[model samples]
Target chain A: MTDHLVEGVLAGDRRAIARTISLIEDNGAEAQATLAALHPHTGRAHIVGVTGPPGSGKSSLVNALALYFRRGATGERGEGGSPKTVGIIAVDPTSPFSGGAILGDRIRMRDLAGDPGIFIRSMASRGSLGGLAWATADAVKVLDAAGFELIFIETVGAGQAEVDIARTAHTTVVVEVPGLGDDVQAIKAGILEIADIFAVNKADHEGADHAVMALRMMLDLDLGGTATVLHHGRLMEVVRTVTGGEEPPSQGPLPPARPSAWRPPIFKTIATRHEGVVDLATAILAHRAYLEQSGQLVQRERERAAAELETIIQQESLRRVLACAQGEKLAALIDRIVRREIDPYTASQHLLGG
Target chain B: MTDKKIRVLIAKPGLDGHDRGAKVIARALRDAGMEVVYTGIRQTPEMIVEAALQEDVDVVGLSILSGAHMALFPRIMDLMRQHGLDDVLVVAGGIIPDEDVPALQAMGVKGVFGPGTSTDTIVRFIREHLS
Candidate 1:
């Protein structure tokens, strides 16, 4: 049955793909069977992850990137020797109370829907800590097996936990824009470290240059190099030289330069205009090549596989523990915990052991 | 026996900060006994697709008040096609002008709902399509 699903997917049957993804998302017996059958046909596609702070035009950037990939097929080095097929996975946060996802990503990427070669799916994190829905990896696998040359996973910018995309994707792009308040500090830690490329979207804004300069400085820091900082003392000295008066070179010492481990390239773009998309795509492809050449691809994929296994185990274990405690016993335990009679850990242990 | 519920994913894509309509539709859908996934704001086409796949949803409803519908809807359709989700109905709401409706539908969007559309109307449309 899984093989039949794979054959249908490869033949571009939308219903088959949908059903297969449904199976994977549910982690049902059917999905596992399907994946096992399709596993052999996987590993040929390039997976890219796009993530950034909210309001950075990530969707627009993705739209443009899809267009760029489609355009790439018209040139040399193209597979299928025709319009390339692309898969997109848009991950959105779910409402805690509703167990529902507000899968609103279609608004920004409507332009590509008409194309026959592109497939897009929206996923909800369903309160998953990593900003990646549990179903994402399997969905990507399904698309990969279906023979999409490029698969994009777009994640909501939920800061720390969202960095999981780095492990799942072959290449990760971090996106930002001007006026995001302390642009550098806003993304300095966690997910920022995982980005292979940084995009400065909304370049049409006034402070884009400053944002770019700050990003470059941060990149320099990441690369273990000192970035030149124009100190107030130096500025005062220059002012005094021009004025020939007594300001005595302002008091504060120069800002210290911090070195870094890797410097991701920053590209400016007005995502709505589709400007700079070509360059961004080129940089992404180039980065993919770099990863492959540097042997990072193999390492990354291994790490991703390990993490996925861990996640699956954790999820399965949690499911078992929860299922074991359901009904009257579960309700009673919850009542006890809430009433401070027993802690959650003890209750969990009791439930699991029983 | 209860009627089969319609599962809907209501998402806000790109930089649009407005979500009043998205939230309203989510509630309306839920009230109608359709499980709705409200993906807040700032979603990409990829995120929306992933949600639909995970939730095993029957409809993907996009709320775009930012006038980005033209550039966004097509990417979603393309993804649906690639993932073989053409049967999953795609709909759009929120501030959509009349002129773009035809184009949106042409791109495989099942329907477009603008402001002033009641929850009952939207829910009925989804049910009718699903049925």
Candidate 2:
């Protein structure tokens, strides 16, 4: 059964691919076996993560991007005559009270369905807090092994700390809307740091130019383009403000830090109208080129592997300790820690020792 | 709670602009620990079947208040078969009449829910009917 399923997945059988993803979502023992067989065939597809706050037009933008990849900017195949097979995994949050979710991202992506070149999957963030579901990585591997050239992972409407998409995707497009805030809602350290491209969707709406200007101003600060900023209508010490009103941390007898060469380009878009999406798509391809030329692709892959290893180690160690010392034994350790008889670090050491 | 959730697709496929009943069933099924994919108002049969194929849903609850069940169910049922969705338990709700229930059942709609029917009944019917 496993060999047949693996063959079917490698051949990109639709039913087999769907069933494999379901198994991954269910997290059964059979899933591990199947995934192990499929893992060696992964990493060919380019995974792109599109994330932003609620109602930021992420779903529509993903739909537009998918359409662009499968068709093109002019609604026909542009340049490359053959279309690229695309896969989409859209996520929404599960209800905390009921442990259920309404995965409605498909509603915006109605046009992509029934197309042989595209496969869309909707996921719910089932208790995982970091923008994506627990099984997203595995599901992406399934699609990757299924020979999709490009895969887009759309996160649940994200907040500042929900930047986990960065670890999973090769190119991260941070979607922002106008009037969200003065400096733009995507300007937070977490959000700004993760963006390979910034798309200000809903450009026809008011405040779009201002939003673009705000993002440009902030990126300029990071790019060392300006020493001053118009903050609250005041000219401010940008460097000091960036350093939290303190002197810059100095590295004694060391070379000064240099900025990364690739700057995330900001694109204005009306996703519903398919406006500015071509430029956004071009920016994505350009970013991929930069990553390849700069050798950052291999570097990022290493980082992702290391992070996954660390996470698995952390989870497995905790699971092992819990399996042996659950119930009163674990409760006693927790009670001792709470009573200040033992610190958590020491408790962990003891747990590991025994 | 079971790790394997019962996924259901609740869709309104008709000209009915009012979908309060569909939304109600969607909410109830969600609260009952099922992942409900509610494709908002006015979906076609092709769209509905495509969703079921992708989602691998255990049940598909079609809510039609436009009184087009006889006209729509056959196409939906045909498409479901064409897509090889033999194992999916299909049911309907919202403003269905008593006399139309037999035809709908013969067309492979296992349950027909009408006005004032308890949400519990719909839930129980799905739970019991799904293999």
Candidate 3:
């Protein structure tokens, strides 16, 4: 059965692709084996991440972008010039309080339905923070191995973890709406650092120019362009006021901080009207070409692999520790900590047999 | 390894614009610790079944207020059977009349919720039936 599944997925069988994703979501031994079988077939898809706050038209923008890519002029193919496939993974919040969520990203993407070359899956956050489920990366791998040339991962909500999906994708587009106040500064302070491209969606709205200017201003500050320090300093004062007169806490350090030779470009788009979507798609492909030419593709791959490996190691170690201390052994350790007989840090040491 | 969460798909089928009941049931199921997928309004029977198969949901709850249950529910049941969804429990809710309940049940829908039905009742039915 596993062999059949692997072969079907390799053949781009939709049912097989869907089933494999479900298995991955289960995070079981079968999923591991399936991933092992499919690993070699990955590294071919260009993973693009689009993230923004809820109601920022992220889904609509993604819908338009997917259509643009799917309908784009056929380019070089894997071998025989077969049309490219597009896969979408839209992450939606699974309310922890009720354990329920309306995964309505599909609602905004109704236009892409019934296309054999396109696949869209909506994933619930499932209590995982940072805008993605733990299984999201694995799911992307399934689509990649299934021969999707382009994959779009739309984040559930805004946060560091959500922005972290950009870490896994080749191009990360941060979508923002007009009149968001300090929210722009918050993203500018945190997630915007990873943005390879910025799309100011709902460009038909009133504050679109202000939003684009704000993003350009932030980019100028970091990109060392013709940005004047005095002007930037005044903007920072406004940022402070918007954020309650305080700078957001530093995000420590991260990639996209090393002054990459490539600078993120901003595009104004009205997603509902499909305006500027083609330009956004062209920019994404151009960025991909840039990464390839600069050999940054290999660097990003290494970074993504390192992050995935770390997460696997952390999860495995925790699982092993908990399995070793199941039932009364675990209860005893917890009770001791609750009784204040030992600190949690010391209890951790004892639990690991240190 | 023994902990597999119950997954449910709550769908509004047949051009029904009233999704308030569906949303409520979805929230209730989630509060009961089930992973619920709400396919928004106007889902066809084919779409619902495809989603059920893709999401691999253990149960499906259809919410319809457009008075199209007799036509829609049977088509959904037939499609589910065709898709080898024999093991999945099917339920219905919203404006369904008493006379239509038995017909729907005979067609393999396990439960029906009309007005005044509590979300707990629906949740408990799913737990009992699926378990």
Candidate 4:
């Protein structure tokens, strides 16, 4: 069965692809077997991430950009052309209060409907804290193995956690809308550093220019001494001036990290009108080329793999720890905690030690 | 490793502006410990099939009130077959007439619920059929 699924997915069979994703989502032994069987066929598609604050028109932008991408490819790559097959994964937040999701992204993405070359899926966050589903990366691998040249991972635009997309996509596009009172504040700090490109969506709105200016100001600040780096287990800004050339000056105490060669470019777009969508697509392709030329593609992949490995270790260790503590002892510990006989930390330590 | 929650895709097909019923059904399904993917408003048969495939949903509930059941349901069934969704349980709810329900069932739709039907009835039907 795993072999058949691997074969079908490699051949771009829609049913097989769907079934494989389902299996992965279920987290069954078959899912692990299927992923292992198809491991050799993964890692071809360029994963692009689209994220922004709610009501930023990110879905519309993704829809319009997907249309442009679909128009460019004819099932294979050209001499610098659009991709043939496109896949969309829209991650919508599940309500913590209700465990329900609206998943309205498809309402904006209906234009690509009926196109055999395009496959769109809506995923609920499923209580994952990072604005993506737990099985999302697995799903992307399924699409990649299915031969989609370009795959878009659209995250639920919920502020800080959306930064997880930077670890998932080859190129990340941060979207913003005008007339939202705190437009500048919305893209502050952690969220600002993850952008590979910026799309000022809903550009036809009244304060579009102002939003663009705010984003430009932020990017400029980022370029001037606010460098992005993963340091001490966090994304930190290293303030360093470039003295002689593109590299930071080595004269004083060495800056923690070097400045990135690529500065995110901003594009104004009215996604609903399909205006400036071509420019957004162009910028995405250019960024891919830049990543390839700079060898950052391999680096980004390593970083993503490292992150995945850490998550697996963390989750697996916890699952085993909980399973080991499952019956009377665990219930007694919980009851003690409820009765103030033990704190959660001591209970967890006891559980793990046992 | 088992997926405890049943996932269902509730979709509207063919230019239907009425989505109150669809929303209600989606909410009911969610309340019944099911994960429902509501593809809001205006969806095509192709879109519904594609969503069903990607979501790996156990069932697809079509909500159409535009009086295009004959044209839409058959096309959706064909698409589902083409997409290898032969085993997916299909149900329909909305302004579907009593006469059309037979044709819909013949086309492989498992159940059809019409106007004035209780949400509990729809939920129970899905639960029983899936079980």
Which candidate's lDDT is highest?
2
Residue pairs with colliding backbones in model 4 are A73-A83, A75-A84
Ordered by lDDT, highest first, the candidates read: 2, 4, 3, 1
- Model 1: what is its DockQ? 0.14
lDDT of 2 by residue, A239-336 (tens): 31221111232322312343324556788999998998888888887778866876778877887888888987998788888898889978999999
- Model 4 lDDT on a 0 to 1 scale: 0.80
TM-score winner, 1 or 3: 3
Q: What TM-score quantifies how close candidate 2 is to the native fold?
A: 0.89
Worst 10 residues of 3 chain B by lDDT: B1-10
TM-score of chain A of 1: 0.80
Model 4: what is its DockQ?
0.56
Q: TM-scores for all candidates?
A: 0.69, 0.89, 0.85, 0.88
lDDT per residue, candidate 3, A301-322, as tens digits?
A: 8878887899899988999999
Candidate order by decreasing DockQ: 4, 2, 3, 1
Against the true two-chain complex, what DockQ does each candidate achieve? Answer: 0.14, 0.55, 0.40, 0.56
Kindly report the TM-score of the first chain in candidate 3: 0.85
Give residue B88's error in model 1 in angstroms. Answer: 7.5
Q: What local lDDT does model 2 show for residue A313?
A: 92
Ordered from best to worst TM-score, the candidate numbers read: 2, 4, 3, 1
